[model samples]
Target: MSLLVAWQLKDRRVLIVGGGEIASQRMDSILVTDASIAVIAPEHRLNSRARQLIACHHARITHHDRLFLGPSELHNIDMVLTALDDPERSREIVLMCRDARIPVNAADIPDLCDFYFGAQIRDGPLQIMISTNGNGPRLASRIKERLQRALSGGEGEAITKVGRLRTLLKQKAPGIGGDQGRRRMKWMTRLCNEWELEDFAQLDNAMMKSLLEDGWEKDRIPSLQDVGGTCSTRRYHQNFHSTIPLAVGFFVGVFTTALITFFRHRK
Candidate 1:
């Protein structure tokens, strides 16, 4: 299974080994991350959009205006993307990236890719990335569209509000240490589960201040009984019953052998 993860690419060095439309698509995606991007392709081969993007981000991007030469070019690069039309050159670039211990994505060649640029949906601090394990990018894009619509409401703003509330709770709430800390955390979690973005988003600053001032009152706080039982409680007994017989038999056999050996030695 391919492990999905989000990379922090801010100010990191990324090298792209093509300048056509495919390369431009990759460039557009990478540009948003504010990475130090360099495009290595002949100036004549570059598409108009690619050139424009490079020019716009000239401060952060370095256009080589020529084909990638050797593995030496891969030095100090955190990630590499090869969108070259020539399969042989693209394979060579992938090999060089492997040798340099750098992660690379070879465009249109799933076998050579160390990573795939999956379809993503961004909502303020929230980001969702979807991948089909390189089997189908089109399907991933379709799913992304569905998710985009699903999250079109105030989901992002709700997360931001929860974050702000959490910060306020940490600063203002007294008895937030020891057992009280866990109680506060459980109360906050319950609040998050019960409250929606609209619940707090419509409130004025004065109302918010008033709510915080009230703190964790017995009436306002969710009861511990309301929380669902833990997985351990549900599964532990089942596992213990299944394994105890085997465990007991193994221990009995060992003890029997030991006792027999001791009797034999005495004889």
Candidate 2:
């Protein structure tokens, strides 16, 4: 079965049914979702930082301060995360959660888990998730580290710029559909690629508008010509926003320098 992927988890209820180090580690990942957390640990060995976050967020961490093997432990929870180190206990908890129609993830037991936590790398708005289909956690972690080093930089600012351009297109041409959508995507794809070749400030808005109009005209309906163009335009936009602040600063500095130089020469 293909693994299910969920990227957004704001304000969702998440329950961690352990109070030890493993549970603590899982909390670090779950907290990023900004979800409501209700931790049920008998005696939590939370470190300073984890405790600080738990206290600060005012998370509903109900402490049983004992073993959580009872059926009552699974009551009224949306998603359950069982981090108990014992295999049998973890399996039991998973079964209990399953009976209650609740999603559960037993520590180191991906087969039992309704949802498995992938090794994750977060860089600003960009998140890379790596999983090993429940075979090897260590392998997954190693791969995650490699991906972390590889994709440690760049983000979606360029993508966001393309989004803004598409919005502009929709505003200008209300009836942009079928060929229009294809054409808009094509122009966006090309512009985003070209954005890498020069400064964003050098990207003439008039030229972009002209190109977008032209592409839309051609692809207004899927013709044989459209297929060939789309085939040749297989290149997706590169990670152009790898140095966002640098790009922004460069543009800003160039503008200020030009303005000053123009006024001085005019004088």
Candidate 3:
């Protein structure tokens, strides 16, 4: 099976060989990241959409108004995508990338591909990817559509808001490999489990600050009834409340451990 990974593409250099609709679609996906893109294909061969992508993202994208010349083009490139109509040329680029030790995605050429784009769902910073391992892309697309339909937009919003909370938590806890970090992780994990998706979605700046405050001083995060922002689905909300006792027990265990460590160190 394929080992799926979420690659960090920020400020990385990526080379795209071809300027067709398919190539442009691949380009669109990366445009969401901070990658420096290089598009290689004759200016005359570029489709309208491809041309538009270059025009809009000229600062981020470098368009070469000519076809892939040789191996020299692969220099300093971290990744490559070949979506060429010319099978021979696509194969050539794939082989070249392989020689240069760069991961490559070869459209319609599964055997040559080091990676597959798969079917992807994006909810701000949260991403869910479904891959059939080059078996059925059409099936993957259908699955993605179904999943997207099931998600409330709140799923994305909650993640975005929680991410901001994490940033604030870093200031209180500091380095990620010490006692303070351990406490921070346990506290964050407790919040994520005890709070429902709806609960997280409703968090305002004041509520988040209150959460951090409670964790630090009071050692208690309040119930949704006390906070009054969400719990829109009664059935799911009830289910979540049922699990809170167990979650709280876990947090309490963590707190007890921290206290024991502190007293032991002091003695």
Candidate 4:
């Protein structure tokens, strides 16, 4: 049940109805987007992080110095998030949002929320969110940590470079979905497979345009060096395969040690 989606919040208004750590975290996420944010809570209730946001992003965010005033406060609000310690008050705000047809998420109150903010890993053009569908948020966080370790840091820049290449394709071979789209997809896939992560990470503007002009448009894919890329994919595959023997040996040693220790204890 992967129901999570990347909502387009650019220029949309998001209302947060608390001033605690949970609310601060959700507001941190919104700050990355072009969303207009307004937080409602008494000034004294604000945590240190919440106060820091107020001090830093003063121009970008508006924080009301009082408690939520009901649906009137939610006027023109596209989304609502409530992280109040008082569940009753939070629930009341949720009800108001529902009445006004606004999407809402109530922190730690699964049944009242229209959405949940899952553990997330964010890079330039890459965002990975792990959710347990209102169950096991700790596990979701552990999974996010594991994924962060698995990915190479070059990915963010690589994805950004790929986007630049896509933009160039649209300019050189412009068309709105059809054969042109399919052709673009095929070429993009080819590059993703053949080019190493470092190649994309280091793809300069001049090299990017030249690659498209000489390689794709010319109907002749040139040598890797011509556009400053290496065929390191095969080398990486070889390196991965070479580690299998060492992994097997390490696991076998662990199993044998466990068995010997168990038998000694039995004796």
C-alpha lDDT (0 to 100) for residue 63 of candidate 4: 94
Query: Residues 85-173, candidate 4, lDDT per residue (tens digit)?
Result: 99999889989988999999998888898877888888898888899876788999998889987776777888999899889888889
TM-scores for every candidate against the unseen true structure = 0.69, 0.60, 0.84, 0.84
Better of 2 and 3 by TM-score: 3
Residue lDDT tens for model 3, 1-267: 999998889879999999998899989988988799999989988899999999999999999998899999999999999988888988989889989999999898888899888889988877899988767889999999999877766787889888888888898668967887888788778778887775677778887777777655466667655555655553474567669998999999999999999999999
**Candidate 2: residue pairs that collide:** 42-65, 42-66, 154-242, 179-219
Cα lDDT of model 2 by residue, 12-124, tens digit: 67778776677878777877776777776654455565566567767544445556757787666678888876899889888888889988889887788777777877754
Using lDDT as the measure, name the better of candidate 2 and candidate 4: 4
Would you list the C-alpha lDDT of every candidate in the order shown?
A: 0.77, 0.64, 0.85, 0.85
Range of the 10 consecutive residues with the lowest summed lDDT in candidate 2 = 226-235
lDDT at position 64, candidate 2: 50
Candidate scoring better on TM-score of 1 and 3: 3
Off by over 4 Å in 2: 1-4, 43-49, 59-76, 156-186, 197-267
**Who is ahead in lDDT, 1 or 3?**
3
